[model samples]
Target: MLFVAGSTVLGGASARAAEQADETSTAESSPIIVTASPLPVRLDELAAPVLRLDREDIEASQASTLGALLADQPGLSESSFAAGASRPIIRGMDNNRVRVQENGIGAGGVSALSEDHGVPIDPLSATSVEVVRGPATLRYGSEAIGGVVNVLNDRIPSARPSGGYSVSGGTSFDTVDQGKEAHGALNVATGNIVWHADGFRRETSDYDTPQGEQFNSWTDTSGVSGGGSVLFGNGYAGANVVHYDSEYGIPAPEDPADPVHIDMRQTKVQLRGAFAFDSWLRGIDFAGGYGDYRHDEITQSGVVGSTFKNKEWEGRAEFQHGAVGPFAGAFGVQYRDRDLSAAGEGGELLAPNTTRAVAGFLYEEMSLTDALSLQMAGRVEHVKVEGTALDTATITEYDVSRDFTPLSASAGLVWNLDGGWVTSATFQAAQRAPEAPELFSKGPHEATETFEIGDASLNEETAYSAELSARREGRGYSFAASLFHVSFDDFIYKALTGETCDDDYASCTDAGGTGTELDQVRYAQQDARFYGFELEGKVALLRTDTATYGVTGQADYVRAKLDGGTNVPRIPPMRIGAGVYLEADRFMAKAGFLHAFRQNKLGPNETETGEYTDVSMAFRYTLPEQMTGGASVKISVVGQNLLDADIRNHVSFKKNDVLLPGRNFRLVASVDF
Candidate 1:
């Protein structure tokens, strides 16, 4: 369910209604930006399933990792490997299949390289977040065949406030991890120029679970950004710079004595511009970014075991054209270049390589009638990868190079039925080129605790997906549901060989000794199929000017298997959730229960996970007007796993050793100025 704030009860309100409320409350309310499109569109008008989380939602979720924050949402789950890092698993697909972005540009980092590496963006400072679930790959890229998560921030001022200056700050504390966080942001306008600045700091101790404290799960993060923009007639130009640093520990090393923590830092710069013209062309939008990121893994003895670096740059330009014969569309071009390197005592160059790519895309929407719409989109990209590797025993140099031209296309239709109901159907054909790591990796990786091996001969992965969805929004209730299926021609994934290896491959080849005792995994390709469905609905039980009450129900399930009949490893289990909520002019409260069913289907060397339920609640109140600042002030208390349930995520590699946080409470306070 979407969020509602202030005054009259908005129980069971849809996202469209919530957005309308914001506009009524604030004249300058911003619309949800479509990073993949030339211009922004209303959430309700889109054919695909799109989830938008604003500042309030971010504050309410306050999870240690991005995946954890969205895990409860329909068709989403977290690969809860550690408190330090977790990546979102969408429709049972993750890693290279899902794309993470910041303000429409790729987040240039090694987060996708391993589950232990965190995404560089900080949610605490984000203004909003958006998720696109179907056919977005037509515009974003084939890497996003599963989905796309875009984090949006106002580091580069886009608009001036009613007043000359605006400032806001907040603080929050979480009990489970003994975590403290503080953040502040400001925007100042002087004529046509606007300046923006923001900063945040967060620190946490080891988190406690129902069993006990999860040792070495602490984390520290801090960052700051500054930017400015100039607004001219019908256009704006802006640039921003940011620096982020973080430290966190990994608790999955086989030997408790082994060192396993990461110290990471990144510096990024971006520029954006848009212009409107009074000609056949409607508008033009452009964006570019450059990032320098690196991380060092430290052992318990203070030794730098491995260091990884990523230097990347990307740019995009799009042109919007006026409708021609009932067809409205935009065309664009994109370019990206990246270099990855690693070095250290334990560092074996998993993929010391350089990747370069350029692409062009076209998107169009047609109004078949006042109640019907059609959308078509397509993209073609040319990519090249070059890498170098050395044999462990022979010490021989090997050069690897691969090139491919991938194409993606999608078509969708939205029908507005009677009774305030709408339905959509989408079909897409997408292809993904092999990533750098999948093509050149050849050594032991500490993050995943495996003797890594890549297949340079792997073929491109091709997928055909289809989705059908329906939604209804009425005066006091809302409902939405979707069903999707995808078939892959050659899915590239790591498969366990059921063979044990020492710290290095040498142990496995030894004549008389067992190696360090780690599983050996090899990159392989196989035909696969995945299908899923998500259903959600809310109903109002009572409504009045002073108070309103509502109930919500949601369920999601996914099944994935190789063509040979073996289940996919680490797939999310079926989940169902229900909740109750109440809201008034100054107060709001909600409680919910979610249950994940036991997963019995297993792949080779995989274990089953038991079922579990999580209970959560939260209450918020608006303070009285005498708070000094000419803005609203609010306080909130939130609780998760109120029943202290022992929870284990099957999708996590460390599920056997680590449990999720338990019985945690958070105190949150914030003000708008």
Candidate 2:
């Protein structure tokens, strides 16, 4: 049994899952689908490593931000830039290398351009989340070079509810930040039509750290979504619209006295449909979306200092067929267009730009035998970017346009052993085109306090990677492990230039002008290598019809360096954790602790972070059905950082100035009818 999405082993034993399996495994039941894939197969058939969080797991975490909710998972970390601006970091990769998506579509936002911008999608809207790494990333695009974080909300209903309608809602409160949230969702079905609607609101004051209150570190956000679907005998058509808004403050070390924050608004619309065929073509699925996003950085005087906006649209179609004997697969084609601009303070950080790309991908699998299978995938994309670049020789801005054709491919072997054990080995070669900001950014970015420089001549980045994974699942025990290595040619990175500047880049390169103000960094390329390993295991010591006891342990580590041995910036340190728990028919309780080692692998001009221990405890209870009129009611209390240790995220750029929230407790209540 497993309390995660998709496979029992690949999704790892999450923190709460470490307690006990809530339900028994069933071989006759339908397999959980991994929506990240255009044409997903069964769990044991996957050739790459993955981690997933189902609805139950998500409820227990109840984090305010998506990044914070997943930070404890194996092989995952967050930028921790601020209370509202954190983003997920996977396999020691962040920024443009990791893709953040929603419901099988790209979450069109500017969070990747800088660490201070927050991802517009909230976990409150997600029913589950998947973290996919390794060769499987080819299914998306080179943008997911490191990995992909796909948040599945299913706003559009494809099937009817058990009853004519179903309703669920809840409210939560926390002590650490004095935060409160309210959310509700409804689904209704009428004959062949299904409808869905959901909304949420959240607000929080400054949070308390181990030292004291963190000033200007608060968050306020809300969002609503409505959708419906029409189901036919052989297929279905659906559409959804979403609106999100948020405003949060940033704790800038240099301007601590002056409050700075971001005000954001985003609207997204999506349309999708599926059709089944009787000919050689099995079926076809198509989806498209449009998004308009904008965020304004406000200064102390309440004036909009810098405004960033992005308008984008994308569409893709996937066709499934078994044209080749003994082989089944899907082919997909995608097109995307994006326009972005910045205005007001430090507006020159990046001139107005537009990026367009078209791609075609193929995935095929063959069962060599009942116990062995082969999986192959390949993708080719053509990309073009328009922006402005600094003409170093001429010392002025110049119009620039660059084009690239990137190709990626992978091959893997999946083997099913005896006693429910599975293993996979994969090799991939991927190429990525430079993003707009990576090739055209100039002038200063106030959020990071850096004078940025980009090179239009930058070439495509390429990676050659290999991965080996194995897992075993049984009634009483489970184990999972993965090891991966990646070698990159011309890896793109920002290099510090040991110079300082003010509102502009002028005088930054002068010998006497260097100061403790904004630093100067230029995008550069170099050969690099990254390697990592993850391990998880759990054992059920006692089991009964109504009660079970278990113990769980997990460990993960990653190392990355430039060809000359220089450590990569903002890499998460290794962590080892273990826990114990008990489960009863109506009550459950669990406790866990994780210890992070001291991070001494310092990047250039960076300081090392101290080690710390994080401890958590939780208790849950469900009311008797007789007391709720056949409805389900649940209450839970969760305690985090029970150790009250002063913690700093080694993977954050603001780690030196900002400390993680201190000891805190949260209470939640929910009902399903």
Candidate 3:
């Protein structure tokens, strides 16, 4: 059954409604800025759903990773191996399907391949985070079919002498782990030349859990970044470079018989430059970047391995001219090349792979009328993959090559109505090619206790999605609701056929042949569908000289089907949450509770996960007098599984054996200068 529910309000209608609700309300309203264009545009004018996490919001959340912070936002989910490893899921899609962008460019690292790996960029360093919930096909490549999460930092050398330094030291109660970090950035300007430099180092000890104490786990990370620019008559040109390294791992239990242990390390380097033109081709911009990354992992199964290297190069050019009526457009081309090689023990090459992609796109935003606008975009990408397949039997390999061409497009309309109401509707068609691991993996997945498999004949997956939203903004109260549906063909999934090896373990075998049992894993394609609704709003309750307070509420429900069947694995359940925030000029506090609905409907091969709830609180304040040039202190307390609920994330692969973190507490403190 296809379900669609929601009422659409015209653009600017919410603002009118809010004005009608209150005449004395002084709530400041502003449009969100998005990097989806060569030139930024206001979110309300972009004709898509874009969530902006401003600097104040980031400081208030006190999250450790970008994935963790984004999880609580609408249309986002999180999958975590531990506190140190968490990946973000967007609209029921994850892994390579979602693109993580840094200042409109790719992160160019191993984060796209594995779940346990962390994003190399630091979340605290970002000035803001933007989550583009609609098709970003015009700005990014085919991989961004799901959406784009851009982390913007101060990478560009500022032409002003302004910068700050921060130092923080804290400890975790639940993990009994202590950590310290320091970061400093300086920007100097002289005549037409600007120089900037920043560096940071962070270290942490092993962590402990309520179940027991985990050992051998520690984290050490250090990085330095610098850039310089020269202002000229035509434009400003700049060059930037960054080098980073980190070593971290998950420890085994103290029982000494545990077989699960992971030790991982990574190092990355990037160089980039950009230029803007003023003469001849006015409003034209160009930029290019190069990146190299290396990773190594050591497991307890004697499968010591290392990935030697992967390099990426990308270039883009765009033109923008707004004086041409209410119609503005930008078009550009991008190219990326990635090469990777891996080796096991004895310095033996497991498999070597290389991929190249080229794409071109155009985006146009037109103001159809005074209150109505339209956004149209389209992109085409050509990707080629080539590599040498390892033949374990004869110790010989054969060459493999494949190419794919996919096209994506999107259209959206925004209507501005009176009475503080705003409405938008969007339709998008996108496709994604298979990732490297999905096409070539052949080994044991010790973590899941299963033999892994892959097929080189896999094809691209395609999807079509549509969404409608309505929002009303008011001084005393506000509300917004959205309904969305997405359908996919050739959706890739892992299936279990109720077959096992004689060794009493899961294994794949030739059922029609001589009954020879091998590994127990294969990637298959299936038709899939997802539909859901999300609603969120806030209300200002009280205002006074000493204190101001507000209430916020949000709810989400999603359902997915595979091959027209009711069973779909790894789907999150309906959730509802509410919170209150109180603040003074220099002090602020927040408390909230989250409830997750039970998931009883399971696929023939699915497991059931019970329902649960949790509560959390935080507080922050500024010092009376300046200890240094500038000073502030922040403290927060978070209690996971506050109800002591024996709950597990329904979407987790480890749901059968592991439980979410039990009742635990975490406290944090930081200072800025």
Which candidate has the highest lDDT of all? 2
Q: Which pairs of residues clash in candidate 1, taking residues 3 or more apart in a chain or in different chains?
A: 259-299, 259-300, 502-515, 502-516
Number of clashing residue pairs, candidate 1 = 4
Candidate 2 lDDT at 95 equals 84
lDDT by residue (tens digit), candidate 1, 1-673:
1221111111111112223222212212355354534444544456785766677777877576678767778888888777768888899999889888887788899888778888888788687666776544566777899988878787866566556677777899999999999888888877878788899999999889999998888899999999988766666678999998889888657657874889999999999766667767877777899999999988778888789999999998878788788987778899999999888633564647899999999888888999888888899999998986545456455888889999999998888899888899999899999998887776677766877667777788998999999988787788889999999999988787776666555565432337656677778899999998998888889999899899888899999999899888888999998989998998989888889999988878988889999888889998877765467788998888889998999998888888888898889898877
Ranking by lDDT: 2, 1, 3
As for TM-score, the candidate ahead, 1 or 3, is 1
**Model 3 lDDT at residue 640:** 45
**lDDT of prediction 3:** 0.60
Give the lowest summed-lDDT range of ten residues in model 2: 12-21
**Candidate 3, position 270, lDDT:** 34
> Can you tell me which runs of candidate 2 are displaced by over 4 Å?
1-31, 36-40, 510-516
Question: What local distance difference test score does each model get?
Answer: 0.78, 0.80, 0.60
Candidate 1: global Cα-lDDT?
A: 0.78
State how far residue 44 of model 1 sits from its true place (Å): 3.9
RMSD to native, candidate 1: 4.0
* Best of the two (2, 3) by lDDT: 2
